[model samples]
Target: MSCCAAGAEAALQMDGIQPVSADELRLASRDLGDGTRQTDLSVPGVHCGACIAAVEKTLSALPGVESARVNLSMKRVAVKWRALDETPPDLIGALDAIGYEAHLFSSATDEKDPELSRLIKALAVAGFSAMNIMLLSVSVWSGADAATRHAFHLISAALALPAVAYSGRIFYLSAWSVLRRGRTNMDVPISIGVSLAVGLSLYETYYNAPHAYFDAATSLLFFLLIGRTLDHVMRERARSAVAGLARLSPAGTTIIAEGGERRYVPIAEIQPGAMMLIAAGDRIPVDGVVVQGASELDCSLVTGESAPLRIGVGAKVQAGLMNLTGPLTIEATTRSENSFLAEMVRMMEAAEGGRARYRRLADRAAALYSPVVHTLALLTLIGWMVLTGDWHNSITIAIAVLIITCPCALGLAVPIVQVVAARRLFERGIMVKDGSALERLAEVDTVLFDKTGTLTLGTPRLINTGEIKPEALAIAAGMAAGSRHPMASAIASSTRRSTLEQRSFDAISEHPGLGIEARSGNDLYRLGRASWALDNGGDEADTDAVSISILAKNGRILARFAFEDSIRPGSLAAVNGLRQLGMSLGIISGDRAPSVEAVASALVVDDFRAGLLPADKVAHIAKAGASGGKVLMVGDGLNDAPALASAYVSMAPATAADIGRNAADFVFLKDNLSAVKEAVDIAHRAKVLIRQNFALAIGYNAIAVPVAVFGYVTPLVAAVAMSLSSVIVVANAMRLRSPQAAPAPADTSAVSGVSLRTAAAKP
Candidate 1:
């Protein structure tokens, strides 16, 4: 909601514009599934809530458009529409008709911000003029004679005219653009006031009057430009997180052709199934699985962890991970546009949208603000004229009213805080899917966590490997290597058999929840549940039991293996922190009751449910929310996706299943559970600051507007007051950037539970 020159440069450059063809528009759009597509356009003229309302209203009314959302921080609009009879909607033409020049948005980080440079240059001119004019005005104010006062006024006029002409175009062009479209904006009143002040000063000087307001006119532009410049700079600072992330993507990658020749391929041209040759020091360009060689990757950008991860053939890797150790060849799984990096950028941009209730209120107020200010200014002029018959004083008072009641502060109240909070969350390795999620998170009083991936790391370790024979462990590892189940991963990592010693399995298959089954030299092998592998005609024993996995050959048990899911780092501190904040904690998990109970007791959470399906988890969340408390769900499995969506506000680990991660409102990239408490702390503080901003804006208006209308405030003073309020609001939102301590742990001595260390112990 900055009153800055957001789109003025685009308006100035809109000469001989042409409509974008439907084919071109279609080429730039993304297929969102279900016959719908999304097209993002960079609209440089959009800076405030009213501009957002105007553009979205115009675009949403088009033939096939389903929705249009404006991200003011990015100065972009995303339009979702269905093709009507194989034709794309005329989005570009519609925007042009409404006075906003637009083109397809490019996520490249190198684009320059023309409006910011223009503001800075214009500010320089206005500042120089204001200083010189103030020096001349001092002689006139110090009781100079008629001839001397007139001479100083003429010199002031010479300095002020060119400065207003140069520095004032930012508002003039913006006002003209909207006015010609039969609409009014915040800039309309500003343009009128500045114009009238300069005009009246020229008229008085011609009549040899004792005073002229050339100083007021030039100084007004200077102060207004200061606010505009600061607003633009602060907003760009807030959007730095997304820009920094975009810079990590390489421009292109080395592609290995079919004939074994390597060639450079641009990232956008790298298609699925293309073989990419990644060097030892290069960043991964797309999501892929390793096909040859091995490497250690610095996955800090993706996972928020500083440690290096080792990957070999068959290991899945995402884009933005730094390959630190050795060269590797990988087959791309998705195009650059659909890669994990692109998705993360989109999510971050979405977090800046004006979807929150507070922003909606601010927009509605701004939409109605311009007309009300016009009426108030006109009434003040008429009142003064009827009272004193002096047209000069009356017009000057009207100009003051216009400059004082600009509503810049009111427009900025909500969005500034949202941008600052989003930036803070991003710095902490948390991605907020929507800005409104922060508002909902602030109201949460109860927190429910999933057992496996949410509270624990979801990676289990084979702790009882000493009890199994080497031959039996090797056979189990061979079968386990083919499955992605947690226990299978544990078995594969714990027993490292050489390629020659590894048993060759003729066939291998996995039974969803049961386990892995394989065949080697006509001998059958099963590495899963005892009941399922032994083919016993009885109920499943693994549902309520501990983590004892059985290895059987030809229906006889060879060795019994056990695993333990390590507690996520900071789980104790996280649980204690949430409790310190007066939150009620519980566990809802799909794990065996014994495992879930062990983790729950260690974390000191009393309310627990285990062995529940996905639907049961959703029902539990729904039931908890029905009791007049907002429930925050934290989980990381495919089974938790439904529950994540059903909760009031949900969070997930970066290692979560794709479905669960997408469903959650917040995604924490770090392995530590401490991010949960950190996000909550930020949300609560943001809510408080937003309230404070609203109060400051309203309080300023309540005191300043009446003084201007009564002629006690001049146009110069009014301009200073308006701009200062905006700066105050921005400065208040910036308080969130200060470092906040992680919530301290609550006392756990009175709670009865298993020891966390023993439960996650490694042999």
Candidate 2:
């Protein structure tokens, strides 16, 4: 029977599938902050580039949908849509109409993969049957008598029938699913080839012919299943980072009630301001502040730091951190859905845009592959029939042509390499927000860095505190207490042990890119840049030593306060590594010229710009790109967000402001500057592998197809060839995980005049 006829007899019952209510969908969706809502759905049937294009195109045409994207590696679809009269889009129904079954996305990891289990079972049956049939065929090949050979052929037929029925269903069902919806995928040709081979073997067996192909039919199923199983396993390994993060969150936490009673509640029920008691060995359940106790925390998983962090009252802790030393009571600051762990998982699973260059070409090729293979097989059959005048021989060769030309290798080329590269970066504490960013990073020719908070630690310290009078220090510290700037923080912290009386200001305000101004009972006090604090022009030329902020009272300088920020660990190494790779490096900052120049000279970078506002940074990045240079911007501050978004590619540290982190293409958790060079190196290697994979895939078809068309290969040989091609591509991608693939740069442990601490204390 035809596959469609068989499917009709076992069609899915609509009532068995529960529909998600609109209210439930609304609650699950996230607001995109642009009058649109984004909903994610899991479609297990999506496995290739064609499926990605089809699903995205179908959903994007819906009434309220502004955009739709499919993540092939995750088998999920994200749709952004505007609400119409407060109604949610019917995403599940639209997918069902196109012969796909979808449901609301859940972060819960499945204990077992049903598809992988089924593939393994199918492989076992096919392998057992193939060995047994090959044994029977050997006896026939040795010239057994007519009656014995006939009986053996009948027995082989019996064994092959059950094996094909059980093992071949994997391909048959997938082929039928897409065929019924007026589409074709790689599986269509596979199903046709296997069925024809089996049918011809059965016919020759019943007629007592001299030759039969029962061994060929069973061996084909065995090899195809092997390839499918390995592909599934490798893909799973590439995406394990996201799954590992999901497993870190606890199901419930002990919430302390207002009346001093404690009860275990689900993570979702813990709200903002709720007091939760965390045990000494439990993972933190939410992003919150430690309100009552002191303890050491194991923050390796969250921040990629191996050392335990010491926390006390008012210290902020993020979710996924492990409490190691003492029990603590903390007030929750954000819901579990908005926690840091959840955000990382979301970023890792984000889909690449449909317009990415290589992805687009691959989709087009997959879409056109099925029809081209079908046409070639049809023409081969007609030409062979005319040349040989034997229908059996012609049909067999055509089946060989179909099986040999399968595009499995082409389909796995780009995505598998991308997944492997993403996993590699994830292991080093770097998160890639988009897969295509790696492709772009490989093309960068210039690297631009922000000065404060980026090249330097941005946490300045008071170096001239002992040189100034005690009363002057007291006044500066009191005025600095209200500001959060790194300079102000330094002053306040340095005077923690002073015995002077507290000084209060009637009014104080901080100006961006400048300093702080205060009014103290008709005595004007300024604590900031010299030019802005004093009216004598401040002799700007004399303020070239370090970062200097003047304390002026009534237009007279009371004290000169000098500060210095620690150079970030590995800055010298990162600069040298990038320079060795032949990239042009520069510094762009809002700091004074002296500070920027000092850092630039230390790193040996010649192109430097300072005293620029946020807009100026953006304009510089734009002009660089416009001049034909692909720029990689590295920054960490609220003011750096726009520049990060404007650059060709950007990276930010984990301590960067929320907006800046969100705008960056990559975020590194550790404080080391080496991550920038590491990312660039890995990207270059990944690009090389992707190109090699494409070549191997195209080159395989170029050689194998003609041999099958001319009757030089059999169905069994075609299966083995196709399977090996895919395995070769996968094995090449696996090389990325090897130690020799991406080697570490030379060690700089003894580099002079730089702090080697990888983690800094929170300010």
Candidate 3:
């Protein structure tokens, strides 16, 4: 996405860095010589340099606190001070008072990002003073009187002091640190710039030798800091989604007991076999069976399908899902850890924390540019000094080098692009959970899809019927109503059988890998395979007329009902679209070959593997991935979890099993195969915008830096150019919203009901 926004798309924008007072500068520094304690605090939400100043300024004013340096991009605060007589909670509270939520970072070697705000602020102040100082000196060029000059010099000195103490402090400290380490960073040139200007200005002010370059030092600081803040803000926006997901789950759940009892019970405290009563609109407490009452539950969280499902007695429900209708009582069958919702949350957390194959472009750039910029700054200083014998002129040239090459634009390049592109993606209902998943998606060349819920109407339907009494259909519906089979359950629902006598048939037995059987009166009822019922071998010729054959008490056929899973409406189109995108598509299904092949043909899949266990799916994905092509696995069943994880990037519809959905890097709420195309297209568009932004930023700097170096550009002019460059980048990225130039991904067909949208649709 472009880093700049056009007129209608403008949002909050960043200004150049403005340094605070010496008192503020002191907040960022401390004398570790006093045997003070040190602590590293991490706040994942810190967005800009202003946040840094807010945290530092508040802590610095505290009685025993020494110094605090807050890294805006890293969201880290480094503090050094004598042990607080106050407790850790008090210290945490202190941080909280400044709008910062902090947690103590436990790592002994916590890495700190070099704060860009410091440079941006320094540049802002330096630019402002540079203009004012130039205006004041112009009058002095015409022979001002003693007091006129004294007053002018005094004003100049006053302006220079804050710049030196606040914005310039980091440069000085960095120079000192690098000096000690036998190396130099970009700060080395900055330190030289400020030191020369202020030192020479002080000499002139004290001894009345024309004028000093105090203005130059301050101007340099301001420009650099502005660029820095823009970079930080963009990155914060990019990560907002994952952070928002983290906040969705509550820290604890409220459980009710007898006599209106209530307490804060941690999620982990929930155990299986507990009778949990949930009120309307409350999150389901844990995975459990509906033991009392009935309610409509919103399983959007579990399936990504945006529909509310009705849950009645004997139905299974899970935690994190909201009860949208009436209150219900549940007999918990699994602990919180085993609940589907918990598994989704766990999956998201793992995906967020797991290391992707590639790092982000911005981080990689920062890593390489830091040392290079510092080296280039050093070279600029030496080159300028060689060309100019006068130290004052050389310092001015060196400061210009530092100001122009601050790495602010370079830092803003990647993050700004990602933020715009990601926000656009969120609006389209495709969530890329892993920040790095987009890069992986761009590289995907092979796609593996799960059959049951992925490519076909995972739900079953009554397709045909033969010689079955209405009463017999009602009885079968009532008996199979509570089953979990994809077929029997749906066929059982083709009638209103709720009023059927609740009979406990004798000899009730469910063959684990097969179907159910029972005895009522003198009738031995069989409800699965035709062969199982007739006590004969399964025949392919007869399989063509596949139907459920219910037997009567006297070996007569009570009824024959045909059930078939419909292919999703757009599944064929989606398969075709992926093929157009140069992806190889195939299917792995747990269902038998006949069912799997039938659905695959509808989708026009080239290859199909049937009766796959979860491990088999994983092995297929793994084998495909081993060929060096990124594999995107789309699935919804529990059996597809491993395949989802092993693929380069995975996606699942909201109705997918919790573990499978969690394992996926992306989740499509609407569940049409079209989302895959839409998401990938969006990612590709984002990459283009990012590249455009990179060019705009690099080109602007290419021209602007030379102007600043040659002294042809004033501080005010530089700020305007920098701001305009930023606006352009953001505007470029926001263009993703226009559908005509960037058309929506095409959907190939609507022949079946594969969209999770259909699943979520009310009956």
CA lDDT, every model vs. true structure: 0.85, 0.81, 0.59
lDDT of 1 by residue, 1-763 (tens): 2663335677777765667888989988998868899999988889898889989999999999999999988889999999999899888889888788888988877978777898899999999999998988888889999998888888888998999999998898888887888888888898899999999999988887987888888888898889888888888987788898888889999999999999998998898999999999999999999999999999998788788998899899999889999999999998887788887887788888848988888778878888999999999999999999999999999999999998888888999899889889889888999899989999999999998788877776677778888899889988888777777877887765334355669999888767788987879998887776775623335434446677889888888787756677778878888899999999998866678888887777899998899999988888888888799999999999999999999999989988898899999888878889999999999999988988999999999999999999988888888888988998998899734645433422322222222222111
Off by over 4 Å in 2: 1-15, 256-263, 351-355, 465-482, 495-542, 550-560, 738-763
Ordered list by lDDT, greatest first: 1, 2, 3
For this target, which candidate reaches the highest TM-score against the unseen true structure? 1
- Candidate 2, 446-564: lDDT as tens digits: 99999877887777787777799988888888888878777788888777656665468899888765677788888998888777788884865555565678889977899877776
- The residue-by-residue lDDT of candidate 3 on 1-763, one tens digit each, is 1111110100111112132343333333333445675555665434322233446777777766677655433355666766444322234456544433455643222234334343455566666776787677777777898778877888988877876677656445535533453543445544665676577678778887675555555555554445445455555554354345434444456665656586667666766776677779777767788888989988765545677888788787766678889988777777655565545443333232222223244434433544655565566557667777666555555455544554444445554545555566555555556546766787788888887677765776665534556666665665565567765676566663344443356556665544556677887766655555544523324443343434333344555565555565456666777899888888887866766666666567869898888888888888887877788898988888888888888888766876777688887766556777777777677667767766876787788777666656543344445556765665576576512223223433345533221111100
Stretch of 10 with least lDDT, candidate 1: 754-763
Tell me the lDDT of model 3 at 722: 55
Which residue pairs in candidate 1 collide? 7-44, 7-45
The candidate maximizing lDDT is 1
Name the better of 1 and 3 by TM-score: 1
Q: Tell me the TM-score of model 3.
A: 0.71
- TM-score: model 2 vs. ground truth: 0.90
